[model samples]
Target: MGREIYFGQQELTLKLTGITRFFAIRRKVTMPYSTIKEVLVSDFEAPKWMIRAPGTSIAPLNIYEGSFNYGDEWYFLSFERKEPVVIITLEGHSKYRYVVFAMDNPTKTAAEIRRHLHEVV
Candidate 1:
């Protein structure tokens, strides 16, 4: 019941409850491990040109939620810091081509996801 990514038995679940979802501008997302194609973690400073529509985007505060078009692909971004974030590339009939989420420990989160992905493969 804490604010952490839950790697479920069949899918990856990100919990977004209470005020965190509104301020953070994100909803709880669950994606099957089978859909994951790649996972990358890196330091990300919010870009000035990220247009948020139909989705939430508060660039000045470094808070982005919802979906944005980038590189001709739609990405789901949920974060509020200029620190390490995990970018997950997904395939198949998923809602987004990529998903970006900030983690307290991006490196650890990425590793956990990678481990689960490998097990599924």
Candidate 2:
């Protein structure tokens, strides 16, 4: 299944659906727009060395969903294919330093998030 991104009045939400929700062990993640540091759309490959603290990963299929820990940084990833994705960097976030997910329109998604970030500022 795919993921959904929602922009709220003061926060951005990433909602994981279907089997993704089960594998990710999270239904949704919310962060205040003020916490967004950067947003970009790019091709991403999950580091093979990263540890999955509580998430699902299928390396062969490039399916990764849930929380991952690399060094001291925490990341929330949700992607089924190795395509372009929206990577959002955050500051003052309690759990994740990065939130990377696939969207139907990555460029548009990133732009929308950026607009929200600017508005919050």
Candidate 3:
């Protein structure tokens, strides 16, 4: 429904399943641990003027999925509601500078990501 986050030996993965994959126009995004700069859980609001180059957005329902661009920065977002989501800030990434997504347990997810990052470093 939302997305699944997986921690691999050298990378972290975000997999969009079911209808989310269709809306996102993407199945999965993988980034090496070195690229992950920070992870946080917060009530993030998608910018009002973001350009959806190849994504789906339903403003009334607050559903946003796929790639977005704003102020010359690339963002990959997959969230269905106005709630707390995990925001992963990345550096040295080829494409996305930020990956924002909603999860069933955003706090736990963020903690796990932090643990993984610590282990990788």
Candidate 4:
């Protein structure tokens, strides 16, 4: 599937879709600005033991999407390491604690996300 992340005044939407519209596995995740706790630009590598149960990865296109769990923490990672990614930590999210995604300019994206977070507060 392909990916698109859009930031709005009150929420961020992550849209993922497979090849064609007919054969697409689309997932749209909407996150409220208030739910974000922290945003960090970091280098990420899936752990050796990590597994993506209901996920998809197209290595050639540099896409990796799915869930990774470590002890008490679970993370939803949809990253294409063509560039650096911004890790967004969440509050009271039962599914996953973090969301990691690549952006054209992660530093600026992180700053903008922080700005939205502060706006909500």
Candidate 5:
């Protein structure tokens, strides 16, 4: 197994294991960097349906979820897979409604977790 990489909150210390085959994921939904603005961060939790995404079919999702409020912004973390499947959820208000920035881009280095936050925040 390769070194674990994450796309969500570091305080949660979420880790993924079966990403040995992760490089094959498509490009539209995969990248090394992205960014969302005016994130709400809270409100959305780890959705149960995510276990069905592109990842291990036998192991249940081990994503960790948490939320923190900063000023009027709420930051939510749905710690999805560690490599091939970490869920980085960024909540933001769009057109006067709440939206979840769930278009996560894998392939990032382990040291690039901050870039993930930048993609979502």
Candidate 6:
């Protein structure tokens, strides 16, 4: 039941499977790209309460990080989209040792990331 989600010029749609977490943002609504960009620019580091993951990690669906170090926290998965790279953890661990780090590409600079994010589809 796994199907691909597509994002092109002016279209966005989803084909549901048995499972899927918060990943791509549908273009159906006008999204605040600026806020996303801000988050992506500075939040992919390890937090202040880093700890071992409770279970084995899973690979991401795209060019993304499965884990990141913020300061003292650990994020399980990071979803790379056009605007930001969203971090993910277990459902109840949104704080402390488990949290998401919204980020842009690490290899690329912020300006480069913004350029990629605003590409004409």
lDDT of 4 by residue, 64-113 (tens): 67766766777777776666788888887757678887767779878887
Which of the numbered candidates is closest to the native, going by highest lDDT? 3
State the displacement of the C-alpha of residue 16, model 1, in Å, after optimal TM-score superposition. Answer: 1.4
TM-scores of the models, in the order given: 0.80, 0.94, 0.96, 0.74, 0.24, 0.24
Query: Taking the tens digit of each residue's C-alpha lDDT, what string does model 5 give over 2-118?
Result: 323334442212332334234212111222233332323232343443323232322255443333343444433333454343334433322111122222443333225545555
lDDT of 3 at 101: 95
Give the per-residue lDDT digits (tens) of candidate 1, residues 1-121.
1236887888988777655577545667778888888899986665566556446676777767666876556677777776778988898736777788887788888998898888877
Show model 4 residue runs off by greater than 4 Å: 8-10, 17-26, 57-63
Candidate 2 has a TM-score of 0.94
Write one digit per residue (lDDT tens) for candidate 6, span 19-78.
222231111112223223232343443333433343222334232323444566544433
In order, the Cα lDDT scores of the candidates are 0.74, 0.90, 0.92, 0.69, 0.33, 0.33
Q: In model 2, which runs have C-alpha deviations exceeding 4 angstroms?
A: none
Q: Is 2 or 4 the stronger prediction by TM-score? A: 2
Candidate 1 ranges beyond 4 A from true positions: 1-3, 24-26, 45-51
Whose TM-score is greatest here? 3
Clash totals for all models, in order? 0, 0, 0, 0, 13, 14
In candidate 3, stretches whose alpha carbon ends up further than 4 angstroms from where it belongs are none
lDDT of 5 at 75: 36
